[model samples]
Target chain A: MELLGIANYLVLFLTIAGVYALLTLGLNVQWGYTGILNIGVAAFFAVGAYTSALLTAPATAQPPGPGLPVAVGMLAAMPVAGILALGIGLITLNLRSDYLAIASIGIAEIVRLFLKNEEWLTNGVRGMAGIPRPFAGVDIAGWSAGGALYLALTIAVIGVVFAALQILYRAPWGRALRAIRDREVAAEAMGKNVLWFRLQSFVLGSAVMGLAGAVHVHYAGFIGPEAIDPLFATFIVWVMLIAGGSGSNLGAIVGALAIWAVWSVTELLGQIPEEPITGFGALRVFLIGLLLQVILLLRPQGIVPEPRE
Target chain B: MVELAQLLIYGVVLGSIIALGAIGVSLTFGVLRFANFAHGDYMTVGAYLVLPFYAGLQLPVAAAVTLAIAGTALMAVLIDRLLFERMRNAGPLVLLVSSFGVGLMLRSAVQMAWGPRTLVYESGIQLPLLFGPLRIKPDHITIIIGAVLLVLAVHLLLTRTRMGKAMRAMSDSPELARVSGINTAQVILFTWVAGAALAATAGFFLALDTNLRADLGWHFLLPVFAAAILGGIGRPYGAIAGGYVIGIAQEFSTLVISATYKPAVAFAIMVAILILRPTGILRGN
Candidate 1:
């Protein structure tokens, strides 16, 4: 590949990695810090993506979206996703963690089904296209220039989110969250509102995920129901969070990049094989599954273990 | 009245499959104290295992079912020994995540072995048998009978056999059961075998009724989990009742909502039940 080609691919990879980094950080807060097993990460992602797409996309006759500013759509995405997480957490948080997992997955499926079936809203299965790219209307040299600009924009967002999360992680609220996670009954005895704290973490984390989704849809210039595969978008985030060492924002970012690299490498290998495509596709997923098992068995605490107080 | 009866029968048939699947989940939760996310995949494995005997070897239906049951039971035991047994001391969350990994692997393996194309046990559909205003099929009868016999057999084993007593004792209180000199390892093995066998039976019947696909079990995963939770997480009898409730609710939901939303009904019922009575109808430990 030429130098420019390499740089282009590098920018693309970095841009995607930054988006995932946002998601991982969100997950780190929910699962790592607050001990809320949210298995429906894609639901929040979809909520954000669709919210932005409908708001920012050009006025269309079919979906009937209000062709508002992209910034407005992006701004709306966070609270929309947060409200959804709040409602779901309110209903299912009373159950055990495992039950919460099951319920969250159910909600995700329902969200996906709604996206698939509600043509008037999500444009059916075809998905909405022509989602306006950020700064696309600005005077740019070409698509490559726009790509680089988007990459920089994504990184800036990631940095902002990372810094904000780091500050929160060191705050008294974060400590109380950890307290509840480690010893809920004890925390309650200590006069901590355990459920309320957990709910706050859940809402905040999911809002971050929604922000990432809005960024993702704008970057891709399209949004679809198929775009958010839970295995890739949700479980893979879990794998990254666990592998990179949960409870650390920096660790979540590192894990996202590292796991995504491995995932891309596997995809490249699948493409190289001349045999049936499905075989390699299935093999890739199977290997990931095996990797998860091996990781859990060998290092449940992860490589960059959560720091001790 | 006939339409209601028909829906009820259809609901019962679906409930039977879910009940059989949920029993294994409940049994495993009772003995191991963790929700096995891969339980539904075991159903898929069992159904796929039968293809070799029935489709490849062209064996009789009965023979194929027997082989599938044995194979799936053995696979369950092997999985327990290889993956779950080692994690006996791990936290429930860790176990739950591992089960998810196992489920993903099982699903991927099924897709790899048998392409994504859907397959059926028999090519032609059987005409429904009419009795007064009601209509049923031979396969439906078989499913109902098979489910009843299996449930009865499980009841007998749990109540009449020594192993059954050991299992119940262990589920009730594993620490006490161990202190009382019951063979914990033996009971665990028995639990896996029984649970897997029931899962296999459910898969076989599901395949007999509907088309077989790689995602057959994955699609059923939510409903089965809903049943288990509704029935009380670790109570076998509770799962049965939960399964019927879910199935009937799902089938009857079409009257008011789109049929595509049938699965959501299970989720609604489960959440409602959990909120109203966390202990479930059976009050699981």
Candidate 2:
């Protein structure tokens, strides 16, 4: 029984880690290989989660879904987020990196406002519940096999994304992105369309972030404003990427696992009543901020530094 | 007509708060060559710093504010010395990311000390005095007066004072200023002091208007950035004008849109600016 409990916990941990790993990988495509500082990660995240939740959730759910297949909802989330990126990228990609960062923050805020105010579509702040999982009802050997099956699904998706991104990382397209990042003037001199390439990267990465959100909403069985807060959905992703080494795909995956573990542990620690833990949430933030600062200052290469080739 | 007038008044008052915040942001952006993301939290820190003096120790408002400004200035210097100063060579994006971390740290620290719940310095109902067709709160009047005085003082310091001139020189050309015998480090220190002091005042005024929460300054960050960018990056005078433009537009926008989407108004304006004139109205680099 203890072993089964431990196994269930492991399944939960890895499933969530896989979702974060997906987000980190997407971020790498933009910030890592392409050098696009997309600070509005939470916007794309919310877009993806809400799109899927609204599409796949049953009509009985608040903000009633069309009750589509889970696979269709997940697939549709990518383009919805991509379109958002396309619109924002058309305007913001031409600016300097810092300006892009601030503008991204604007987009995130706008998305948050949309989710909070568009109650008819999103069920307002109460968020839609009863989001069904793919294999949520399967049981075998007098025990539910749904947990293991979902974990399998998450791992499978991560595997596909990881493999595809790895190939892209080494292709000519990836080299062009690196060129644009390293020296935009030189890339322009070499006849590369800098703005177009950047927009493509931004859209692609954001689409992936949307997928991560879709996966997340399904596991949590709901979506809400809190799920999309920039501090959590966005800032933590940045921390994971930088902590994992930005330019490397494998590093992105490793970083997600490590950072998410630490975050989960911190939450567990916060629940202790006798530990003199006042404002545990704040302390965790302070710790992560300090961690990011220390890494940036000292070992910016991260635990799994980007591979040369 | 009355509603229009009231909105205009609200715009100017809000604009004053943002202008104060943007002045600090513009100065630092110009001199440091990076958008300090921790700037909003500097306002938060400065505001909370005053709470102990004004509310806890029961010091007079003026004295408490002075101490808070000094304390905030000192804290900014300390952060720069400890974290930012070392990353001087790390480039702007690195610095910007570091400021994000600094902002989280500052805000979380505030939460740890003050708790995450919202608090108001004065919870009593503030009755607005009728000024013909417009109703004006006394606090609004005080904020406007204080902001105008501060803005005038800043304008004088920038145009007249040697330190201010040196800072401007550095902003225009850091290397050239350095080679031309300007003490770039000293100017940087002065920039933080000016920015943090104004941010302190902005925070206090913001709290006067709304209750204090851990995320109060962060909530204002969008409009503050909008004002700074609209004014033109690194132009203090432009920032002052931009603040009013953004503030008033945001307030007036509530006529058509829900008030919760006020930040969206600023975001729309900022996007328009980015697409139409990336250099901002003043066209400063």
Candidate 3:
């Protein structure tokens, strides 16, 4: 609770927000750029977290588990998450936009439920603990120093992702996606495989979410299915994208930071004493809900509004 | 045979609840022309609102039930007028997102009013009615009866009545209904009243079977959506049938899969239905 303590908290918050920024950017690429409402984004996130955690968290001399190095764990997470997304997209790609949204939500929920119940793989509700950090033996100065280090690493990853997305956005493939999004039939007439484009967007989005999750797991040093709850993925990320301006990468990053700031402050306020502040916890949540409602009603386009044609 | 009978009874009872839930979703989707993710949360609020009536006032069972249903209906209509109606003309995405906001607000409000714990409306209600190897409870019977009465009333209201016809016209084509001199706003209000009444009633009956929790309707929203889709979106009768199909499927999935993984069954069925035929089983459209 000291100033330094608050700084430490801020650093931790920024790191997590940066991770979400990555996740939201992945969503923006799918939803904003491609108009594909991928509601099951969290499934890949779970895959990544579970993958990294299960692999890196030293083998417990037990059966039915695959424990590997953290880097390798991160590597496995991307393909595993991507493949799942591809499978889901294959079945759902032909669906209308709204139905696609509903299906993805269902898929995310199913993945979460599986992770929560599949005790042999996920350790069930007890959750996996003791996930190791890279360079665990190194005297990382202090928790604040660790926070700074994590933030720097996240920033690096974000930079790389942004660069890659920049290239895609400028490429012919990206233009085709935009065409498909803006006018599916016209894009179809032009011989663009709309379904295939959608599937690719979905798989790529899921991969990005997985990478974010991999970073998040190592940072938080734990993994549980609850971490990828559909509500968190849909509601929170939706809010972030809207608050930022959906179609813009910068908007996603800014929105993630701003919303995460509000969330953090409200969460902290919820814990504050309530002599003159009765029901602060509930009030904080209420305010967040109110904030979202007000935003949607007054400015449906959002803060950094996505440019309209 | 007895086990099958029992399953059927349970399925019907569950179906009744599903019917009630789907009414809210279908009506909102049909009339409002947008997916209201918050619709389930309203059911959650309706159940929570029952706590004061049933538990606090300690009124007679029927009286408390009536009060709860009325209060929830009023709340739903007010929400429609104040919130949903404003966004009625917005694009689907805007409406969807706004409803999410509304749902979050309602959920937080409930969590604020009543903490994140489950409660029951204290009752001296007895055990299941034994019929051979099968057993069913008074709550189940009440749910079936109540849901049937409500649905029949809605059916009558929608078809036999002038207002009902207007609603149907509106659903078929809102602008045409308005041009035809139907009071579009009034029909919308009526739809909310009817849909919310069904929802609150379902919430109450669901609370009877389980306990009242803030997340009750949300937990059921997926299966309820699956039911609505299975029934072909906006058809009430289809929804009723679909709900039963969903309920039975959900319960039976547990026999094949682990009980813990039973919830995933709803999504699997939903995906299969969508992939196989997006129009759904009933073919209302």
Candidate 4:
């Protein structure tokens, strides 16, 4: 590919990676800091994406969108995602972690099914299109300039989220979360109100995921059921969070970028000459799953191990 | 009345598949103490493994099923040795995540080998048998009978045999069982064998009842888990009852609601059960 072509792809890749970093950070807060096993990342994500799409997309005859301002739609995403998480967490968070995992995945599936079947709300499988970009009509120097601007905007969002999370992780409340995660019994005995703290973390983290979804949908200018594969979205974020050390905000960002690189490289490899394998897609997924196994076996703490107090 | 009876029969047949799969899930929970997320994928693998023998080699259905069961059992043992056994000391969350990874790998392997398209054992559909107001298929009878016999066999194995007693003992108290000279490792192996074989049988019958697709087991994952949980985790008998309830609820749901929401029925039952009675109907440990 030519230099300009490569730059465009690079900008797109970085933008997507930044969005994923937001998600990884959100997951890091829930699973890493709060010890909540939320397997419904995609559900929250879809909630945000659809919420924003429905609010911001131009009024259409079939889907019947509100066509509100993009900024308002993005602003609406966090509460929408947070409320859903609150409802789910209230019911299932008090149970064993296993039950939480099952319940979360079930919720994710329910969300997906609703999105697929509720034609009146989500346009069914046809999905919402022509979602306006952040600055669609802005005049730029070149064609690639818009891509670069979006990439910068995504990075800025990531930086703010990362900084906020970093400060939170180092704060007393964050330490309490860590304490709850490491030893819930001890934390509860210390009058920590463990469930309350966990609920906060779960809601906050899910809202961040919703924000990431808003960023993603805006960048792509579309939202659909096909946009999110429940398993791939959830597990890949997991791989990123675990592979990059959990409990560390920087690790979440690092993991997101590194895993995205590996993911894209594998996809590129599948496109190589000499008659690529017919099942290359499945093979790539298999390799990713194997990578998770290898990491768990060899480095359970991940590349950037959580810092000891 | 006939329609209700027909739905009940269909529910029972569907419940049998869930029951077979849930038995393994509950057994694993009892022994391993972690939800094996790959159990559903194992079901798919078992069904896919049978394709080579039943369709590719044109073998008899019985021989093919036997081969598939053995192959799946071997696969379970291999998985235990390589992935799960090594993580015996790890926390339940770690094991659960690892199981997710294993499930992904298995699913992808099935897709890679079989392609994304659906495959069926036989092309043409058989006419349903009518008995008065009731209509059923030979496949339904086979599924119902197979499930009952398997459940009965498991009951016998647990209650009548020495190994079964050892398993029960271990599940109750592994440390005590160890002190009592029960071979923990061997019993664990036996658990996997039994669980995998049952799952394979369920997968086979499910494929026979429906069509074989990569997502066949994936789709069943939630329902099976719901059954296992509803019957109470780690309680095999509870899983059987849970399976029937879920099956009947799902089939009957189509009468009032759209069929597309069938999977959600299991989720609803599971959530309600967890909220109302976390221990399930059987009140498992």
Q: What is the C-alpha lDDT of each candidate?
A: 0.87, 0.90, 0.78, 0.90
Evaluated with DockQ, which candidate comes out highest? 2
Q: DockQ (C-alpha) of model 2?
A: 0.87
| CAPRI rating of model 4 | high
**Candidate 2 error regions (>4 Å):** A273-276
DockQ, ranked from best to worst: 2, 4, 1, 3
Per-residue alpha-carbon lDDT of model 4 for A221-292, expressed as tens digits? 878887778888899999999999988888899999999999999888777878878889899889989999
- Candidate 3 runs further than 4 Å off: A1-4, A60-67, A140-144, A227-230, A274-279, A307-309, B123-125
- The TM-scores, one per candidate, come to 0.96, 0.98, 0.93, 0.98
Q: List, residue by residue over B1-285, the lDDT tens digit for candidate 3.
A: 666677778778877888789877887777767767777887887777778876788778778777877887898888777777777676676667677667767777887788777777775667778867778887888888988898888888888999888878887788888899999889888888878777887888888888888778877788788888888877777787788888887776665788776667778888888878887877634
Q: Rank the candidates by TM-score, best first.
A: 2, 4, 1, 3
Off by over 4 Å in 4: A60-64, A137-139, A274-276
**Model 3 residue B249 CA deviation in Å:** 1.9
Q: How far in Å is the alpha carbon of A101 misplaced in model 4?
A: 0.5
lDDT of 2 by residue, B55-173 (tens): 89999999999999999999999999999999989788889988988998999999999997898886789999998978999999999999999999999999999999998998899
Count steric clashes of candidate 2. Answer: 0
Which tens-of-lDDT digit does each residue in B1-285 have in candidate 1? 878899999999999999999999999999889888888889999999999999999999889999999999999899889888888787787788888878888888998999778988779869999989899999999999999999899889989999999988989999999999999999999999999999998998888889888778877888998999888888898998988889888988988999988888988998898889987888986
Q: Candidate 3, clashing residue pairs?
A: none
Candidate 1 - chain A - TM: 0.94
Candidate 4 chain B minimal-lDDT segment of 10 residues: B86-95
